[model samples]
Target: MLDNAKYDQINPPSRLLMGPGPINADPRVLRAMASQLVGQYDPAMTGYMNEVMALYRGVFKTENPWTLLVDGTSRAGIEAVLLSVIRPGDKVLVPVFGRFGHLLCEIARRCRAEVHIIEAPWGEVFSPDQIEDAVKRVRPRVLLTVQGDTSTTMLQPLEQLGEICRRYDALFYTDATASLGGNALESDAWGLDAVSAGLQKCLGGPSGSAPVTLSARCEAVIRSRKCVEEGIRTAEHRDGDDEMIYSNYFDLGMIMDYWGPERLNHHTEATSMLFAARECARLLLEEGLDAAIERHKLHGGAMLAGIDAMGLEVFGDRRHRMNNVLGVVIPTGLDGEQVRQMMLNDFAIEIGTSFGPLKGKIWRIGTMGYNARKDCVMQTLSALEGVLNRLGFAGPRGAGLQAAWDHYQREQPS
Candidate 1:
């Protein structure tokens, strides 16, 4: 089974990632990850863990003391929340907007919850009243939604949904993986009970870490089901009536104890990924969250302008598009995958394609995290124009780049 002979040292080709996520991380984050590891119990390591918790509070725009890092990717964070809070037969409502909405439903179903789903067409998001109406009727224990779904390149508006959930006495949770840092997410202000995100997108890091925040209301639900494992239970303990969380690694209660004042042992802690996550939050706070959002908006706007000028049709409702990604409708008579291959082979640039029903019909272009810059937008547009022309889909040579430049010039303050 081994194939060591065929593999070489880790030299990978350089590519400009202009897609949905896993965009190039900030250089400082990588540098931090390279530092040597420390023992899990080491004072310095635990100190960094605490700092990470505090730093992410700012990043998430929350004062919730339960905010902490999950040892896996964004989906891990989602599962952690769902598994800990949702008991068997509990009703959970997920409004399907795109692929990730379906993902939430799937996970909740696996957890043995009674999953109810409402739907909108792929490119559209539900209005606040629509979600509230469902909340009133279904009356789910949790209302699960995604802030941004890369598959559709649409950002669902959450400011109103939170209040709706509170009015109906339901917990509100959102997967902010594609929107956090690059977009506005106010956990406390929005009244969100819990929020989860990944480092691969606007956080400027890879996919190994997930930063999650939980409001006190959500924490109470998780803590109610807390069960100290056999190895960690003391003589004074008694099990609670609530069911134990199904997964050990994703048990947020245990995870919290590890990150909290007790410093209870759970796993050994992913030391390098912890560093990367910490540095991501640090960089974002240093830049300021508002400024980061503005950066994504500006670069993303430039990309839209470039695509528009290229005579390309954009997919989805323009009013609901995410600030970090674009869904460009593949031109008729052009082979979509063929164009993607040329972009990768010749330009060494990576863009994304859609999933589910929209697959093969659109290309997802992202300007996010460290790659959300004037240079990245211009380069991607130029390369894409070249490839399109070469494929016999002819347009003016410099129209794409010119449009992006003009947008930048117009937006620049005097």
Candidate 2:
């Protein structure tokens, strides 16, 4: 502790974040977080909380009353939902399409659930027919899937699966952290029981807070599992059975009571992060959901065209690609890490590498939120082309930039 006492004066490189997450946050969000902090239970703070809930209601495209911010990252929201809703021996069905699906199964297993997996190969999504058959056979209590799996750049179709889950009397849940602000997702219309997201991806904010919404059904289930904790012990005959809550901190039952009208004390709220989350949702809602989705589509389309013009093969089925991210196969004779490192250190750009079976085989480029603008797209493509050219990949000069410009031109009126 005594050595190296002085902190290094440093400034982070100004990077064009073109990765799967932690994309550049909207400047408005930064300003909001920088605003004066208030006490956790300050009236102003609570008012901000209420406003955040209303704002994210629009972000999720849901009328669900249980929408709010969880006090951690996206994965915390995922675990909160699972730990709250699932009891021991409950049968949970997870459909594996990418790394996140495996994460869901792993979390559910930790909850002591009998987890069943319906899987498709990586870089593909599960068909409705396959899911229907699995749901019918498994008779699971909950059917969970990731709306967008960034690792594979695939969007799982949910329009029909919601009806399937309803018919089977199983709750449907999804983690939309990677897709919410960039794609069209209707939580209420899609019959989603619960959904969770984070601001690090398409929402254009920091990753400390998680935005979550739970349907009335999901809320009711969590409320039913409420337990009296030792900190708030009472002397009403003192004969209650102290059944163990799965996780005290993540207990949605207790959390709901804390956040609901009763306003019981729980952990101190992450006030700054909550402010940031609220502003992120406010920005999206002000922009309009359809417009945000369209922006993502336009920029993502430009990215695809740019990558194609570079003479590199794009991975995954074209018909099912996610609107904000693209997975491109690493060209032959070029080191993927070298390209990624060059983009980061040399050009101040950040793109993603693949995971699991797709690792070292593909590079994931994202066009999302603040980074989905035309300039960002063009700059990324331009830098990428230069990097690729330096590595001996042959392509038409300035082809990627030209293709992206052409796509943008096509979007303009005659």
Candidate 3:
């Protein structure tokens, strides 16, 4: 009870977000969050929840009725699916191409699944043939993979993996947090049984909410688990009953019941986060999904071109790189963190560094969602060139900016 009021007040600057995630939320979404908050059980609040589900359905390009937002970050959605669908001793085949692949394997292990990994080096993606070979041998019950791994800025090919899983009667799950709104993702057409994404990345919203969709097959499995839980709860009145549910919060069965027409209470819904997420989806749908993806492609390509003109080596195969993020090699004799910090502190810009094996050797630049604009792209390149030049890296003055501008001129209608 010592003078708590003595604490200092702090404020953060409004810098441009050009990093991997938690990108600047659109102003429209911010205004939406300012709307009056209603009670959890209020009719208007429940109606908003229904609209959120419908909005994300369009965002995910799926007709699955179970599409809803998880109450945590993107990883929370990942855990929800894994903990609910993966039973003890189930085989989960994870194709490890980057850090997120390791994340999948780790989460699967926590769910008590037998995990098998087919690994590739960082900055590369696995070929469909390699995945097919692993599937043939492992015969896994579930194939857990990532659509985009931001750590290495690589997009794993899933077009054929889904078919392979279907052939083996295995479920296919993907984490699309990095690629969903910025890339081409057809959840239903791609044969994905379940997919999860966060609002912070390409969706241009805050990180507290996660959007997820599950196929009929996934829904059926969750429903079966729900029946087991219900039978156990009322076992005293019924003759045949099942055992207890493992983790309650991660139980998708109960979550589905809460989100479904039953509208039962699970946790107090994060109202502000839901408004942000719904508005994010609305912005994407209004822009047209394909058009939004094309914007990311254009901006990301321009950023890569700018970096190349600056004499920096672009990491990853160009054909496999994700359209929203780029990894560039840290020049010799230059401190990667120093440049990043200078960008943040001096230029009021934010960029990212790598993780695991690629840490300290690469810098990740993002051109995603609201930041995928010509001015944002040009400003980031200009700032980066200034930082690198000051740090003693030899590169032509204004070369990166000129190159990006030239590309933009060429792409303009004649």
Assess each prediction's global lDDT (C-alpha) against the native.
Answer: 0.92, 0.89, 0.89
lDDT of 3 at 273: 91
At residue 408, give the lDDT of candidate 2: 91
The residue-by-residue lDDT of candidate 1 on 1-414, one tens digit each, is 979988889988999999898898889999999999999988999999989999999999999998898989899999998998898788999999999999999999988989999999999999998998899999999999999999999999999888898888999999999999988899999999999999999988999888999999998888888564654654544343336575788889999999998988888899999999999999999999999999999999999999999999999999999999999999999999999999999999999989999999999999999999999999899899999999999777799999999999998755
lDDT of 3 by residue, 1-414 (tens): 778687656766889999888788889988999988999878898898899999988999999999998899999999999888887688999999999989999999987889999998888899989999999999999999999999999998888887889999899999999999999999888899999999888898888888999999998776665334433456442432222246677788888888878888788888999899889999999999999999999899899889989999999888999999999999989999999999999999999998999999999999998888999999999999999989889998899999898778776545
TM-score of 1: 0.96
Give the range where candidate 1 is weakest over 10 consecutive residues by summed lDDT.
Answer: 233-242
lDDT per residue, candidate 2, 67-186, as tens digits?
Answer: 988899999999999988987688999999999999999999888899999889988898899999999999999998999999999999988888999999999999999999999899
> On a 0 to 100 scale, what is the lDDT of residue 219 in model 2?
86
Q: Which portions of model 2 show Cα errors greater than 4 Å?
A: 1-6, 228-244
Evaluated at residue 106, the lDDT of candidate 3 is: 96
lDDT of 3 at 12: 66
Model 2 has an lDDT value of 0.89
Error of 2 at 44 (Å): 0.6
TM of each candidate vs. truth = 0.96, 0.95, 0.95
- Model 1 residue runs over 4 Å out of place are 1-5, 226-242
The predicted structure with the larger TM-score, 1 or 3, is 1
